[model samples]
Target: MITTDLNIKFYTYIYKCHPHLFSSLARDGQIMGLSLRVRRRGGSGSKKEIIPVTSCSEEVEITVPSQFQCPISYELMKDPVIIASGITYDRENIEKWFESGYQTCPVTNTVLTSLEQIPNHTIRRMIQGWCGSSLGGGIERIPTPRVPVTSHQVSEICGRLSAATWRGDYAACSEMVRKLKMLGKESERNRKCVKENGAGLVLCVCLDAFSENANASILLEEIVSVLTWMLPIGSEGQTKLTTTSSFNRLVELLRNGDQNAAFVIKELLELNVAHVHALTKINGVEEAFLKSLNRDSTCVNSLTSIHHMILTNQETVSRFLELDLVNTTVEMLVDSENSVCEKALTVLNAICETKEGREKVRRNELVIPILVKKILKITEKKDLVSVMWKICKSGDGYEVEEALRLGAFKKLVVMLQVGCGEGTKEKVTELLKMMNKVMKMNGFVDRSDSSSIEFKHVKKPF
Candidate 1:
């Protein structure tokens, strides 16, 4: 009787602890002679407890079947495709692997002779059927995959749009551009196909042609919309589209075109630093960019983009200086919002790299004092400190004296005492040392004077 009770206890423990394994065993008809009993305590007016006995039965375990999983992602395949090696994988993953210049099978590791991916119809039907049934574990049914656009189709669309634009077929050109936008927006693969087939070049040519004709203003907007969708494809595509004449035409459009055209120009210029520099070389481009910086609004994103582009190249900085951008940027630094101030400082940092650019900054009287005040007021201090460091490092005696006169020395000392980052602290130390040597050489300070300058705690500007 004791052996039987121990066996019953062991079976009860296994059934509770390893229910899935127990269910599998039970499903196989392996559970035998298992029973359980619980003793009841404290019955009314009873000294001894009563015991109740029960018998256990078999149950089956429901789980996801193995065939529904993809070999690539190890998850249920939403869009399964069979490769040349006769192995199935999720379509998106396989396509990405193929696009990355890998010509081998992901599973078999064998060199693939073809890149074709056939849809796995049979497995998809089975997965759909399973998802529809009660045994699917509440998994939602996967939708059918859309058919991909072919390269040949994209080429035909490009041909139609180019022909229509050349012949001045306004209605035809509009329709074709709309269709191309839809195709390009459909998927990443379609966009790649459109770019590879020379769609960006076609759009640039159309933009030039339309801009030359004064009556084609409506078509210009349409073409800009289509080109905006097709842009930022690749470096190769950007190079093909950003020709000297095309770039000049784009600058003109930015000056005269509406807000939509301005947005497109912003995106195109942001494609690379090369495009930004190229645009800067055009006449009146700097003026157009500076005019766009409005104080009463928060729409300075495009101006910031231009500033980022200018920060990358020193030649662009010199060009901006030639256009008298220093005074405008200094005014912006003093009066503009926080984000615009950050961008202005970034531009100034780059400009101060050259002697001419540094001279332009030093000549501006408001540059130093406004920058010192801004450092105190702005929460973002890294860019402001960098710009100040560049100025102090590059400035001559009069410039450094100007910085000192504007309370720059006091600000640097306070920043050090208030505990800034090691980099900022080191820069401050270097600038202070430079300033001290200059001051002593000018006979303005004596080494024996211990109380020449006093350091104070920096109070919050707010």
Candidate 2:
């Protein structure tokens, strides 16, 4: 029998009651079970093994270090648990962690001592799952959600950067400049803002009086160099004050102003002119962007920058369409994360955007199958659709005809056929039908294109 304010009572045998048996019941700020694994003692203890209570797995062997012995469990060479810096060698992983030893919780930014329990939902669920499994109840694993970045953040930072520039606040302006430079062309957060016109406000703020001040010139030079190199969006006089649609408005500002055109302009010449031509990195931004892609750990935004660079820059991208680049890019698609795979597909789409890009993709058969896989990701189809459309659009009458003959249409049709209970299949069918209309509009099927032959791609799904 049990008694509580809630009036809930349960019966249990005394033999089942012990600190180890009910350690999970401790609310917080309590040291519990010991894990006799992993940490080893060189000076105080010997080798021992204990099943971890916190891990939902039925058992995990922890090889305790030598010389370390748990005073509470009275176990030697066992698991070392974390309890507010009091490491007991004979303790479990969770127990040691909960001891409040850490300055900050890894999952949550909160300090451990401030909270009775871990602030992270994931950590709590893991603990709960392990506890449930111990009593023969099935453990429910919860998936952690990802945080999305917002353009509002970019605009706010840019606003500060501009304000600092306006007051001759060189020190403050330089710091903001450094932070922005580090963020560079690879930041999805900033680029999205640039696209939405919010980032332009920052550029305008920074450019004012930038040419007249030498210190401000170099600082603004570096910042604009990166933005112009990566973000190629422009319209002549598109600035809030202008009417001309010249594409190099940013680079033009640097060159036309009191800026040492000889300094930043020399560096800007090497950027991917097709996309963001305003940048001037004399040392070579291309090499830098490439290195990021081949890193052991790659970021999605970095990969996106690489793909866009390859797409918008015809000459530089020609180098990527080579056997080496396509091969490496193909492997990148193997990433299970839909965003990573989608970016890789965008790179492929760029390669197939022109006569040369198409030949590169055709020369390599791997790109097709990988693209099919990405398009097949149901939840990720929206991202891939636009890229796929580009690949199809770049095809000339002959290229379009050949691509269909090569079975490209079949792959797209498969996605439409298996669409799970959504209107997506209908949407895909509409796109395909529209493609046929475009061909006709372009005179691909009119009396003008004698070579334009009708391609039957089994119209049902594609």
Instruction: Give the winner by lDDT.
Output: 1
Query: Per-candidate RMSD vs. true structure?
Result: 13.5, 17.8
Residue 67's lDDT in candidate 1: 65
Tens-place lDDT digits, model 1, residues 29-67: 555544322222222212221111233432222334556
Instruction: Please give the distance, in angstroms, between residue 183's alpha carbon in candidate 1 and its true position after superposition.
Output: 3.3
Worst 10 residues of 1 by lDDT: 44-53
lDDT of 2 by residue, 255-370 (tens): 34423322223322333342243222212344444444565323454445555555456675665554256666666765547667766666666666667766555545444344
Angstrom error at residue 294, model 1: 2.6
TM-score of each: 0.59, 0.33
| lDDT (Cα, 0-100) at 185 in candidate 2 | 49
Alpha carbon lDDT of each predicted model: 0.66, 0.45
